[model samples]
Target: MEKKPFFQGLTKKTIALALAVILWAFTNFELDVERDVRIPLHLSGLPEDLIIVNNAPENVDLSLRGARNLLSSFAFSNKSIPVDLQKTERGVLKIDLKRAASQIVPRGIDIVAARPSKLSLNIDMLVTKRFKVKPVLGEPDSGYEISKKLKIVPQFVKVKGPASQLGKLESIETAKIKLEGEKAEFTAPVQLQLPSQYMEVLEGDHVNVTVYIKEIILSKEFRDVDIVPRNFGELEYTTTPELKATLVFNGPYKTINDLTSNDVKVFIDGAEMGESRVKRLRVKVQYPNSDLLKLTKTSPTSVRVRVKPPPPEESPET
Candidate 1:
């Protein structure tokens, strides 16, 4: 009986040893390293879409926790299986639990939790477009009109969002100013919108828009626009006094360009301009400033002012 008991004990020990060895082998067989890796998968080159969301998806959150080894071997794809479009409607997007490609797929992972589980994807057909963000002005003070150069900053911007949503956005407008004859720098915080839908402005939203107004000079009437003379003294000529000079003046276009030979009256110290031949002056009219209407012309060239006294009275009746 003692011997039988001994044999039974041996069998029990063998069973226990075998169980321990099997457990040890299993424990040491594989690397038990797990990691939360972000993997990207292709969205099956279905058409190009540019729809951005205000929030992140849930499945995207859940798929992050995965085994490092498996994730390392996963493939990255921008395109994948065609998503289920049957239930897809405007402002709705449902993530394909199975179809969507991911960079990492855990070898033996059970999805603990999924975000946007059935992503009610507001299926926005995405589109990126370039637009001109121009400024609009309100009625200016009486007699003062707005200029074309009054454009806003960020002259151009890129817009992105659902196709239907983006298509509706035609133009963006800023605050209006009642320009009251002043050089003022104006700024405003503005919002963007479409015909009926709102815009997800990718580049611009609240920007510092500026408006500048130039004061116009209406009461500044012009006169004959005198010709300031040149002083050359103590130089004598044999036959006649030669006073060669150039004339420069600034005035209105009509008065300058319309100047004919009859308009010019030249005389030395207010004399009858004896033998003074008035050459046809060439006038070049120019707008002096971006603000004022003060035009100036340097002439086609310098006007040669010659002073030759009366031709010796022709030696009459000798």
Candidate 2:
């Protein structure tokens, strides 16, 4: 094997050239540089009753000046600017972005400028209010109806929001409830529909709603209902012009629609009437299913009745 020298192919001029290039690169790397860093904007120290509104900036763009090496490392670090609102009042608030960012930057880095030098915020006081919960209901089945007033478990709800918006809110409604083809009573848990995007429900966001449903009540009129006499045995009793009645009944839709004159009776009682030249008696009505049907009205409320003694039949029979 041939012996090789440690300084083989080396020269004094080559050494000087390498040293010059190294120094130039080190100087350039250490030179001051400018860059734009995008960092999050943090809001802190706000009073519990106060809130910032109206499109506040969420992140800030900082124009930072530092050494080339330092700027590169800082871009990856966790950097943010926090704005203190402890003493803020309800109104428009303005803050300087450069001044806010300078507090968090590294000691050697300078925040020369910011994209948005000034920030504007709309501040408002927070308020909580209780409002009635309105239920949004849909139509029921074709032959059904709402039987009575609706029942809500919790009639009122509390909402928190900016005072400017909450002042205009009068009530809150539940998410729409579909009752189409619903025939029976039911209970449901429904969420609330907020009127404003900034409002939040406190304690609970939903309520229990109870709905009542029943068959619809319908009215039907029956014409020419015969009026009969009762308890007039062995006596001739005639109504002065043969009275007939018009009867109106109210019941469930199915029962009322299927009703006929045979289902109802109109009569006059002779036992209740006293002996007089011309007896005036009030008409009465009888229904088999009293629990389901009701008589609402009857025409010819009263009728004149004449009673005659039975013809002399005792002599002929003897």
Best by lDDT: 2
Question: RMSD of each candidate?
Answer: 14.7, 6.2
Identify the candidate with maximal TM-score. 2
**Can you write out model 1's per-residue Cα lDDT over 1-318, one digit (the tens) per residue?**
246665768978999999999787655443453434333322333334534333433224344434444434545333232343544444655575533433234355434443434444445666777777756557556444444465466776777666675566666555454455544455565554433343456775644556654333342323433333323243232322333323344333334444443444332332322334543233323223323333332322333444444465665696
Candidate 2's C-alpha runs over 4 A off are 1-27, 30-36, 63-66, 107-118, 221-318
lDDT of each: 0.46, 0.84
- Residue-level lDDT for 13 in candidate 2: 62
In candidate 1 the C-alpha lDDT for residue 45 amounts to: 31
For model 2 the TM-score comes to 0.64
Candidate 2 local lDDT, 88-184, one digit each (tens): 9999999998998888887778888887889998899999999999999988877688888888979999999999998888899999988887778
Q: How far is candidate 1 from the true structure (C-alpha RMSD, Å)?
A: 14.7
Reference-based TM-score of each model:
0.33, 0.64
**lDDT (Cα) of model 2:** 0.84
